[model samples]
Target: MSEQPHPPKREIFDVPAMTNTDNKGFLRPVDEYRQLPYGLYMSRPADHPRFHHLESWLLPALGLRANIFHFTPDHRSGQRLYLDVGRFTGPDADGRWYSVDWYLDLVDVPGTELELLDVDELFTAHAAGLLTLDEAVEATEIAVRTLRGAAAAGDIQSWLDAQVGGRMPWLDRPVAR
Candidate 1:
């Protein structure tokens, strides 16, 4: 195969940027993935080896799926985020399948890196204390809100950079696998 080019990175906008107000643009209308706080939207986000009650049962109900998420670069914002989604299939009984989605922001700065995600593997990572469901939800929620706000507000590229704390070079070339 041929060599791949570098994608765009994060950029910045001016102070007090515009708000997209298009919350619906990020996730589905159903809001099935909306955060409920406390424990996992799928499993608990706290420490210890215990998931929060209903949270634990949710995994089995949805079936375990996995995903290695990726996001196309955005020239406007200058960052990369994963929209990884997967599904799980359970036994014949009730006939259920679970879905796990991730929206990890790109990080080359300190204390950050791309994380692996999937149904069982992702959950296992969460179980291993890799990040935690709460962290994931909080971060993703911020990302969705921030980006939408910036887009809607018509924030300049410079403002976008400050919001994400990095240049969005990933938007230049195609994203690597």
Candidate 2:
């Protein structure tokens, strides 16, 4: 069997130069695979691991059901604490899915939350071709009026504290199969 070639690493928007305003123009260079619908949301990011674990636990806890997650890139903030947002099935992996929710990383500082962009901007970008119809519809399901929030850090001790019962599940941590 032939080996599968790895996709080339492409540098996207500089990120820091972008602003938080809800402008459709921000959705330029409409590369559907890289920018539209679920494309942007699925990009691999620096904070993906924490978000993955958080999703693993939180989704089931909240009774939300979403096998897929859409973590959109800010591509605007220059700082380490850029705004991160996504959609998922509720806290339970089996529950109804939710979208356009914000995810914050407190980092080393306590009581600090990352700033997030308004959900409408996502839809505006979608309408402008930054996102696909599926992505746009999902954005509509989670409009600006109804936003959600979650927080995490490299260290999960605090994240565990915020859980409904402060319970730690073995599956949340790394395990060998």
lDDT of 2 at 64: 20
Q: Best candidate per lDDT, number?
A: 2
lDDT of 2 by residue, 1-177 (tens): 133322211122322322111122232231111111122211222234333211222232332212122234533222322223344332223222233332211222224443334445554455556566775565444322122333333322333334334433232232243
- TM-score, candidate 1, is 0.23
- Give the poorly placed runs of model 1, Cα more than 4 Å off: 1-103, 106-128, 155-177
- Per-residue lDDT of candidate 1, residues 1-177 (tens digit): 122322111111111221111112321111112111111122112221322111211122212111111222332222233322222222224322233333233221213333333334434445556556774454455445544544554442333344434442222332243
lDDT of each: 0.29, 0.30
Off by over 4 Å in 2: 1-84, 89-111, 117-124, 129-163, 168-177
Write down the RMSD of all candidates, one decimal each. Answer: 19.8, 15.7
Model 1: lDDT to the true structure: 0.29
Query: For model 2, what is the error of residue 13's alpha carbon versus the real structure, in angstroms, after optimal superposition?
Result: 26
